[model samples]
Target chain A: MHNDIASLINSSVPGANASVVNPPEDGAGDSSVLVDSSKIYEVCEFLKTNDKFPFPVLQVISGVDYVEYFEVCYMLASFNLENSYQLILKTQLKDRENPELQSVVPVWAAANYQERECYDMIGVRFKDHPDHRRILCPDDWEGFPLRKDYEVQKVYRGMEVNPEAKMNFEDREFEVRKKEMEADLLKRQLERGH
Target chain B: MQTWDMGIKELQDETQDESMNTELLTVNMGPQHPATHGVLRVEIKTDSEIVAQAIPHIGYLHRCMEKHCESIDYRGIIPFVDRMDYLAAMNQELVYSMAVEKMLGTEVPRRAQVIRMIVSELQRIASHLMAFGTYALDLGAFSPFLYAFDEREKILRFFEEISGARLLYNYFWIGGVWNDMTNAHVSYIKDFLDNFEGELEKYDTLVSSNKIFLERVNNVGVLSVEDCFNYGATGPVLRGSGYKWDLRKVEPYLLYDEVKFDVPVGTGERGSTIGDCYNRYIVRMKEMEESVKIIRQCLDMLEPGPVIGKVSKVIKLPKGEIFYRQECPRGELGIHIVSTGEKTPYRVKVKSPCFTHVSMLPFMAPGQMVADFVATIGSIDIVLGEVDR
Candidate 1:
């Protein structure tokens, strides 16, 4: 059903280059429609308004970094009205330096802050996003913290970011944790008949 | 000085006139104020007694839950997820376990599922009690807060008996529970429910119909059904808008399909309209009864079996992404994990209801009284820990 909706979206909506991305071999997740980053706003608008698949509620917009590019996911569901459906929309931006995507705030009001969060965590700026500022971090805070290559700065206004950075295995708490972990592993192995 | 019958633009055009003296007053309501709840600070722009805007500024309690999940192992992320919404940690753990169990394809034992249902319902009652306690105090009704705490303490005691910790219990494992629940625990839960039902009736008479509480919440901060959908509201907030959509009833995760429970939604009864603060509180109040019903059913369904499922030593998620959502006390707590066939997740994104619901403040706050803003904030039942996670 989700694939049929994706194909309908790909064919009906003009400039929509959406392709269904099937779940991997593990089958952990549902199949998602990967749309072009530039045409995401239209695809999302169509998804909400179209009669065939009207997924009105925009739930979460998450950003993931793949070292070379960023994948921005839009999770939506039709919990408000009839035709209950949970759909995922993905758009990948290969631009490492200035990753950008169209904002879906026009489609759903829930997109307002979630889009800000996406911009805050992974540095994926949403085009035409009103009040597009850092949400979880201060405006002056440097670096996208969620990115795999993100580096923590040595100092923020001379305050120590990591106060216990020099902690070694010789520390009392560390030694206690190591002992407790070993005990837990042994117990788990016994339970598994290892 | 208050005799301007013209609109805002006309008043601005006549700003040179001395009679129109009032300007928009912007007040910061807190990263510390009591009414704002936790570290949520709302910048309220008011014109006289009415609010023009209420911009919520969060992130004071941001703990980088996603960043930590990226580095931690699968089982290790459970306790970390518990802190996201500390009030209802069981539900959080349950949802996270469901996600991980999906990755590993682990089917939980029957007894474990029943125990999970019972404990999560108990946690819901406790969480809603805290919500009401704080919400009533926000509206200056202290007696109800005290009553709520007394009952909440009992639920906490039950939680302590099941798991060691009172607040954040790391009991629900990926495959199943940490330990099996004894039969004695079941009878104790039944007795607690018998007493709790009477206490709930006492509360309905004590505060639910109180004139002042109704005056503070009724018709104030009213959200239309369209506003709810557009704002992506869920849980009681969506239910308060007269929507009967519940994940338990509709989606039915973790043996909810077999259970018989009526999802109570806002009806806009004689005194209060739908989607108002009054209706929201009433929805939660009535939900406790429904929760009690679910727990009674779980007790009958409970059977003797192993608590934990068969899980391997080294757990790794395959290269894929999955989203698991469940009905939490606050709203839908979903965990969307993207993996790379590694020991740790590539990204763990949480869709907390507070984050979306709090955004509705700016939409609902305009044109309401400044005092009602407190009622509005409290009515949303936001936990900043989840909002800023």
Candidate 2:
């Protein structure tokens, strides 16, 4: 199914270099097709309008940071076809500092807020989005919070950035020891046949 | 009524005058208004009473759930996922657990699958009950709000007994459920189902068929089929637009395929077109009954077995990216996880239904009366926690 989608994308869309990737060995059941970042808009337009595979719904747009590069994934589903199939389209950005890709909002209206969220979190800019402001973060927030190197701000507008305290290592260790002691006591009591 | 009629004529005469210029009024609906549902603020441009354009401002409740997912372990993300859609926490947990389970190649036991389906459907009923109650409250029907919440309280009590939490339940785990269900819990749910059917009919008579509600909602905020697809509406919003696209029937995740239930779409039974606010309200009312049918079947299929699958305490997923979606009460809740074969995830993205539903306001709000805009928001059912997650 993925190979058919890749070849169809390559032949139908201009300037698109599409190739299918293998499905995960764990049987997750959907392989992805990598498309050239420059031609993603045209490729998405073709996939959405093409009679063979009219993927009417753009289910999600996810952004992933891989340190050296960034990848934007498009999860599309077709309700028009008899047997519905999900097409995963991935586009890679080699430039870490300025990662940009063509927006698919023209093809799918659902991509509007999802792309803005991707930009706000992972710093992947989508060109030609209608309203490209941050969807989830404040407009003044610095750095993409989801980036691997980004750090949480210490303060915002005079208020301390105090996350609810997580258990420290010593606390965790003490809790583990307490559980083990209780288990040992229970085992000993069972062995006594009382 | 006579004074309102005279005022309309007087205002019309004033607007008709060449020298009298009418200016568009900009009104800020919320970040705190009860009718806005949550912390949603819309800057509405109104020409007299009809809205010209509405621009929604979100992110007021932003919590950066994606960033937290990168730091937390694969199994530890369930509680955070539950917070996204606090009303339907079980459904939210089910989607995240399924995504991680798929990446790890873990096959959940048959009994656990049935339990997950039953719990998720019950959560849907509870969530929809809240939607119904709050929607009525927004429309100024006090009695239905009390009645709806009274019925919803029973479902919450059932959730409290089964999962030990009424609102935010971290009951579902990666491989399976956190705990097994008891016979008493099953009987409690069965009892609720039997009594709730009659209550639903009473609710229908109380609110669904109310003449005032029909007049207020019918033909108001009508969304065309084209607009629905173009704006990526799903669940009841898309179904209300007369499209039969349901993730349960179309995608059929988990044991949804085995369960026999009808997908209720709007047929314009009221005096308006199919995709009006009234149709959307009816679609939710009908869906509650279908959920009851699913829960009954799941209870019948429940068996005694190990709930949790055999997985190591320290969980790790293989390097890949997977996007899993489920038919949540609001719409389609999608979780996209990018793994790097590490304990912590590389990236996590949530496709919240409320976010997309809220985005469609600019398209639907124009030409609608200011009061009808509240009905539009109620029909779409936006939750700020999921929207700003």
Candidate 3:
């Protein structure tokens, strides 16, 4: 797969290198790919158009923000080749006010909503989206909720957002954990067929 | 309880873009319409019968599952995930669990993989049943809807026996499943398969090959293969457009690589030139048969073994990040988990296919009749829960 990808990239595009990023074994290629964000569109175009990998399908596009930088991943699948490939394009949206990224809508029409969502949640703005509006949230909604720094919400659109919204982790706290344990004990007591 | 008449008129006025003198008719199809499986309001702008634009106004059923996912225990979040794409509950759970498993580096048991295959295919049949039923309803054919429901009920009954709930069953666990498949479950599934082929023929006669249904759907809302790819269409929607990109076959997760099943793709001028509502419907109807074939192979391979792999009850995953995805009935349902070597995931991101699927609406909905827009939407099969989540 590595040789095929490298040869494919080398043949299709100039100065394109597709090294094997075996992260689990080496963990070196895990954090970042040695590829330019600007080159993503070109590579994608090549993948979709060229003979090597006519990956006509952009299956899923998602993002993960790690405080300092954001990791925007694109999973591309090929219909003709019958193979799947992941293109993790790294982009840093430094400022929260206007986090902008190049829109892949031109590359894959399916990207309009995924980009809008990345905008709505992580606040990454796609520069050339046809209708880049607040999708999940109301039009005038305040901040991107998915970012690590932003507060979840105490109030959203005048509704009282959960007061414990900020520190609301999925796991139970000690007090609630104790109560659940007690409830389980009581249930077990009631279930005894004496 | 606000009436729709005033809303409809105001919607019409807005459709005219007020500034433009052209009288644009605005019509509200749902929020109560039967064709809209749930409370989905489609604000359509039209001149005569031709729809100029269609804007899907959702969030009526928005419980904010993303917020809920953030607040609940990663494991406990499965049931809510199940609710998002209710038709593809098993697939939803599979994607979520795969993310958690990848983050933790916890390998699932082989037995569990077989079980996952079984449930996922079952859910596929059930989800296709929904598409078939809803597509029928869109075409003003109520009988096919009932027929589809009858088959879907059999699958749901099997789910009820296995998971202890029918609609929103969180049967798949993080490392494995809640429980093993019972003998009764297997037997019922086999019986359903035996009767389904005959029933499917009824569907062909009732709706699929019906002249009215084909006339309503064929050459209507045509989405090309490029359009499907660009828009990130998945499942039957993508397949219906002549792209044979099934995640089960391409990605080969679980025991799918071992399984023998065909990715039945749409063909001909209707499939090529007119990848329309009927194409998607026909593709899904054919997909149900493929799913049935996959399920039979999975069931035959099924044997008694420990369903859950060896993992601590309080799972403290390694500090790592992994993105896991599955070919959900909707599209590629992905779950990205960033672990901090704690019981809870540091950050969990769900990439719902419906989110991307609905995004294509603004692109697909123009120039078709308002009724055809409903049919196209139904053909695409967007679950609002998954869309909003």
**Which candidate tops DockQ?**
1
Which one wins on lDDT? 1
TM-scores of all models? 0.93, 0.91, 0.83
Residue B181, candidate 1: alpha-carbon lDDT: 82
Model 2: residues with Cα > 4 Å off, grouped in runs: A23-29, A154-194, B1-18
Cα error, candidate 3, residue A114 (Å): 1.5
TM-score of chain A of 2: 0.81
Better by TM-score, candidate 3 or 1? 1
Q: How close is candidate 2 to the true structure, as a TM-score?
A: 0.91
The per-model DockQ list reads: 0.63, 0.41, 0.30
> Tens digits of per-residue lDDT for model 3 on B1-389?
22221333454565566565456689887878877677777888776666777787766776666655654567778888888887788889888888777656678888899989988888988998988888788778888889889999988988888889998888999889988888888888899998998888889888877878877787766778777767777777778787788878887889989989888777744322447777777878888888888889988998888898866766666665666677887777877666666556666667778777776777777767667777778888888778776
Residues B1-389 of candidate 2 have per-residue lDDT tens digits of 33222333355465687777567799999999999888999999877887778999998888888888887788779999989888889999999999888888899999999999998998899889989999999999988888888888998897888789989989998889988999999999999999999999999999888899888899888888778777777889989989887888887878889989999999999696899999998999999999999999999999999898888876888877787888999998888887777889878888888888998998888767788899999999888899888
Error of 3 at B111 (Å): 3.1
Restricting to chain A, the TM-score for each candidate equals: 0.83, 0.81, 0.67
- Candidate 3 error regions (>4 Å): A1-56, A152-194, B1-22, B269-274
lDDT of 2 at B85: 85
